[model samples]
Target: NSGYQQQPRQQAPQQFNNQNRIQSMNQFDLIPMSYAELFPALIEKYLVQTRASPPVLAKLPW
Candidate 1:
């Protein structure tokens, strides 16, 4: 019974993190490539707004 109780406690944080990861992925998916071409400067603006680091920029295909 105690093991069952602890199981949920451990799973709760993992579930919460998965939810956050999914939400961020969804947000990124919503941004179309056309938008990047339409407003070139907005890409830099977005990176700044999102507080992305130089290492992150290097990883991006753009």
Candidate 2:
């Protein structure tokens, strides 16, 4: 056959998983946005949701 085939004697090096690499990226929470930057409905919904959430003094895990 003229088709190329891998040599059984050769071994490919293992590669690191992308999931681990992506997770190692810097963590950022809650992108900044003003009411003017958001749709009117979205702004109103976010305000209502935030108001409804209980106030707590707990640190979030990154």
Candidate 3:
């Protein structure tokens, strides 16, 4: 009876350590955005910057 009671207490720490190790290993994998997701944001930022700027003198023939 006592062995069974102690079994759960020992297993809990092992399970927690395994989960922590897995999370640490995965943390870096989660930080970066895939190019498909990042490309649209880059395009939108470029468009916004171009729209905010005045037209170039060269673009105007006058």
RMSD of each: 18.3, 20.3, 21.3
- Candidate 3 residues lying further than 4 Å off, grouped into runs, are 1-31, 47-62
Task: Give the range of the ten consecutive residues with the poorest summed lDDT in model 3.
Answer: 1-10
Candidate 3 residues 1-62, lDDT tens each?
Answer: 22211111122222346346422221223324555565588788785243467666866565
Each prediction's total of clashing residue pairs, residues at least 3 apart in sequence or on different chains, is 0, 0, 0
Q: Tell me each candidate's TM-score.
A: 0.16, 0.16, 0.25
Question: How far does residue 36 in candidate 1 sit from its true spot (Å)?
Answer: 5.4
Colliding residue pairs in candidate 3: none
How displaced is residue 28 in candidate 2, in Å? Answer: 14
Instruction: Give me candidate 1's TM-score against the actual structure.
Output: 0.16
| Sliding window of 10 residues with minimal summed lDDT for model 2 | 22-31
Q: How accurate is candidate 1 locally (lDDT)?
A: 0.38
Tell me which of candidates 1 and 3 scores higher on lDDT. 3
lDDT of 1 by residue, 1-62 (tens): 12211111122222346346422221122333344353566656675344545554546676
